[model samples]
Target: MELGVGWTLKPVGFEDEEDGQDAKKIVDNQFEKMDYHGTIMELGMFYRVLGRACQVNTYDLNGDFYFNKNEKVTGADSINPMTITDASLRKVMADRTGTEPYVQRVTGSVGNPGTVELEQDRVIYITNNPFAKYSTYGNSDLNNSVTDLRTLARFPHYRDALARLYSQMHRIVTIDSENSYNIIW
Candidate 1:
């Protein structure tokens, strides 16, 4: 299957001149015209965590969580747990030549807003209020007014994936002292 679009792999620090030369060749040969397929994958993680925040804000705006409210409210609710069967997150690995199956979804609230507990298998995709603004009310009043606004937390697996991607990017560009380097595959 087509694993989305390709990404440009830029070379960084290299100890050997030959490694730098190789990296330039690789860029010219493969990655020069590649596209990273938008930031959707990254946003996916953000969306899952902040979905509840959206719901909560919707409720505040519409009075009811389902309707559109007048106030600048923010929050979210459980809209059924997200599931990732086999082959959920498929993509071209950082090696730029291989494909890999990665975790797409995680159970439970990737982020939550309310202090009330959530149900099992029913994860809160969005839990924080990103729209919380300053009010003229006193600190205590402001605290109470904006008590619901919170930042969504990231999923552990998603966090891991981000870290791995960063590491891979860093690894691919490293140059050896011998001036010869192997492209990570």
Candidate 2:
């Protein structure tokens, strides 16, 4: 995407410059530890191809749901978009909060499947189709080309068959040649 070469942290209005520098140092350290550049690049690839991407956050061994702006974040790992079954968004006006912001994924084989529900704070989710309000999953960038891709895939076989059909030679022999041979004999 090349939105920016690298990340920068600038002090907000009325914030101390030195404090901003310190915060930047801490963030840079975490970025290095988490391989943020590489992970983001990978996520971008998935987002382009599959129309959605996600990275699950890893926290310290203390406990689950330790998501804060401090040292709670240990690392981040990317998840395959295909394995993600569903994603729910937060409801602002619902009384019961219909569904929490979470992502459900399937793991293991079909014979022995496992479901994992990752809370919203633990995931960095990106989608190509963010305008769809009620949809759970993002639409693929390749969705429009699916039929064209299928035709492209079968083009080689069809072209080869047509070539073989047109390559055959049809020869016509006249009975006059046989009669001429007999007259010569």
Question: Which runs in model 2 stand beyond 4 Å of their true positions?
Answer: 1-6, 11-22, 61-74, 86-112, 156-185
Candidate 1 lDDT by residue in tens digits, 133-154: 3111112223432322322133
- lDDT, candidates in the order shown: 0.33, 0.60
Please report the TM-score between candidate 2 and the true structure.
0.53
In model 2, how large is the Cα lDDT of residue 91? 40
Name the runs in model 1 displaced over 4 angstroms. 1-15, 37-147, 150-185
- For residues 1-185, could you state the per-residue lDDT of candidate 2 as single tens digits? 24113344555663688887888788787677676777677777787788777788867688532344365343676667676654243341121543354545564655667777776667676677768643445777678657655765878656565546535633444334324533211
Top candidate, metric TM-score: 2
Q: Report the error of model 1 at residue 51, Å.
A: 11
What is the alpha-carbon lDDT for the whole of candidate 1? 0.33
lDDT of 2: 0.60
